[model samples]
Target: MYSSIELENVEPRELEEEAPTLLSVGRELKPEKMRPNVWHYERGEENAYHRQGEQEELYVVLEGTVDVTIERDDERDVITLSKHDVLVVPPESWRQLRAVEESRVLAVGAPNVPDDGMLEE
Candidate 1:
């Protein structure tokens, strides 16, 4: 049986050493309710790198504003999201985002296993 569901103050961690950065929170710390190898990510930055692969992805804006670009099935679209806005991308789609203003975005997906995601390069 699970002991607790409370992950008190689930603070973001740093890179390499977990210095309290957002990547850590996004990369690690999967809640019990989520899928195994789930990807729960939060970006508090001005820009994000582009990536694509076999898994699908969803993005949720927490504050401010951001723009997401997606490519799939020979179609391309740019989506702008404000606080509380959400966007979903299908598997095999390429995507990237840019912060129009200081922003926080939550990105979630499944099978975030190492081999499921890829970079264009």
Candidate 2:
């Protein structure tokens, strides 16, 4: 039988890493085209444009709010994503994200992280 766990002086660690002058999580995500890898996307305070590969992806909101833009051949769709909202991004579509209020999002993709810039838009 599994024993009940007990808390022991647990505390949240203070993050000390400096924010990137130019956000490149979009580029960093290019090579890691796999699922189950958790990425902490710092607030860009601006919109970031990107696209997914052949693999499917799911973006789950962890904190704050964001606006997700999905681009198709004929039309562009924009949706507001807030805490607890899961956004599914299909392959071969142009996507961008804007942190509405210092938000945090989790992106999960299948297979391997696709090569950066798989779509042209």
Candidate 3:
């Protein structure tokens, strides 16, 4: 789904040192129930898998492209997303993002509160 201009004003933060190199433009729009925050992850030499607890996400590709594997419904699906591509992740979905090319994205969802629910280690 497309985001409304009013609701899309949220900006994404760059999370390099910890992640990779990329631009994220919607750092705020996280859901109330999940604790919302946004950040962008760039492509690294290595790939990683990640998931958030009980919360869903809408990742809209704002620049470049990336290869992704989304694990859901007891299965794994691979897809390549590029500019303007929007991906919706259902609750409890497991996902891995690998930069097939370079990529930039917008992560909009809850911040994953309760501390234990976020993808941070």
Candidate 4:
């Protein structure tokens, strides 16, 4: 069971219009072995501010440290994660990811509601 692309191999696409470091990989590497999931984001950025609407998400910090801020209901919280650390964001909670240094982050979410993720305005 292997479906892989060097995440970094994703060529220049319309996504470069969004962010040079953002690569839309979930569709291109859909694994037949697993249920469809909302796109998996392979990000190499200093920070990313966004959130999921209908699905909870797991943030896997592959390198460096990331400050995760989640805003829900009327409260907000922040967590610091380093290499190998993982943070789970519940549905509808607003989240912001800021890398303390050059970093790689893989965000995974289940049951593809492909259109449910929205970036902050």
Tens-place lDDT digits, model 2, residues 31-88:
4436533333456553346676576778887777878889978679999988999988
Clash count list over all predictions: 5, 6, 16, 0
User: Each model's TM-score, in the order given?
Assistant: 0.64, 0.62, 0.61, 0.72
Which model, 2 or 4, shows the larger lDDT? 4
Clashing pairs in 4: none
* lDDT by residue (tens digit), candidate 3, 1-121: 3332343454433343445532232323333454333334445422346676755777777777877788876898999888899888865777867665556566555555453334526
Q: All candidates' lDDT scores?
A: 0.56, 0.59, 0.58, 0.64
lDDT of 1 by residue, 1-121 (tens): 4333322345544444221135334334544433222122344443334454555667777666777778777788888888899887776777767667766666666545443556566
The candidate, 2 or 3, that scores higher on lDDT is 2
**How close is each model in CA RMSD to the real structure?**
5.0, 7.8, 5.5, 4.2
TM-score of decoy 3: 0.61
Tens digits of per-residue lDDT for model 4, 9-52: 76534443243255546766874432222222234443346666
Task: Provide the lDDT at 100 for model 1.
Answer: 71
Highest TM-score model number: 4
